[model samples]
Target: MNAVLRVAALGLGQLVAIGLLLFVSAGTVDYWQAWLFLAVFAVTAWLPSIYLQITNPVVLQRRMKSGPVAEGRTVQKIVMLGLYGSLVAICVVGGLDHRFGWSAVPAALCVIGSALAGAGLVVTVLVAIQNTYASTTVRVEAGQHVVSTGLYGLVRHPMYTGNVLILVGLPLAVGSFWALAFVMPGIAVLATRIHDEEKLLGDELDGYREYTQKVRSRLIPYMW
Candidate 1:
């Protein structure tokens, strides 16, 4: 398949997954504006990477064809996907609750939730800008070298940090205790992914261990 088509297919598949969760949780409830924003997030996150990968297939191919750094613990991937699915489900349910006037969220909580969600999104943007060249897949490019600068100068995995921010913020956007509860699982998945990623990097990437020693943390500043 053409790379664009292949990526578009993946994008559609993601949409289907999210859509199923929305259907199951909302039971025919539709909130156009909120859904539109959700779609916006999807496009913003996925589209640029899709275009980059399509335009730079050789870079992607090199990464994929490269030897495994280690046996990746795909359990983290599954758990993360599940958390993302649950975010969609909770958002759908929250929308339904609001539509039917079943929402119990106080106005103060709404403000707090929106603030958290916005902060999370802002963090994601910062990380993306910091590591603009990192691959979407687990592959090393021909010219790709370990990045130990920018955000990497502080933490070994700013992208994972951003992921945690976004995932935690997602529940806040939904504005419910049930949605907020999902953040714990999201954090667990992030922790697992970070561990797995570090294992691979330490084993495969040159100087990564030294880099880690210098940084000393995955997310926090001066403290893990």
Candidate 2:
């Protein structure tokens, strides 16, 4: 099967699973804003993959393993998924609570979280446009060349940075402390992956060391 087909299958499966669970068990819905936020998010997250599958299957097919390609370490991948799950759980539970007229602390987190998640997703789309992914392992193609302009000019791994933003934003949007638990571990995993990924690029990828020198920051602006 092609990359587009594979991605479509996965995306569809996730949608179906989540939809069924929410409908059959949870039977809950958030505010209209939450639904709108989720719609935008789902589209942004999957649209790029769909585009890449059609436009650049080579990047999608070149995986580190016979599975989905992640930009960083495998452990980080699991952690990110966990964090995202927490975000969803928070949304579902919080939405339920809100519907039941339960009180929540720090009301501002809802608005802030939505903004962060939405903004982070926009960044994610931009990174998707700039970076290429493969099926086996992380790599940039021979002619793909490192990007040192735009967002890359400041951070070596803007995608990781964006990922963190969304990871934290999801739980914040739902206003749940339980969902926030994954942030620290997620950050730790991302840090390790960034370090290891840079080391790998320094060794395997051409001119990546110099790129790092020029960028000066891994995930932040003007700082390490």
TM-score of each: 0.68, 0.71
Deviation from native of the Cα of residue 59 in model 2, angstroms: 4.6
lDDT tens digits by residue: candidate 1, 1-224 = 58767766766786566555554566653644345435655655456546546666544433222112322446545655665655655676665665565656665665555455555544554455555445433433354467778878877777666666666655445445556666677677667667776787788777778887788988767777
Given candidate 1, what's the lDDT at residue 158?
72
Q: What tens digits encode model 2's per-residue C-alpha lDDT throughout 76-136?
A: 4664465445545655655554455454647576767867877776776676556654222
Q: Give the clashing residue pairs of candidate 2, or none.
A: 62-134, 62-135, 62-136, 63-135, 63-136, 63-137, 64-135, 64-136, 64-137, 65-136
Clashes of 1: 1
Tell me the lDDT of model 1 at 190: 65
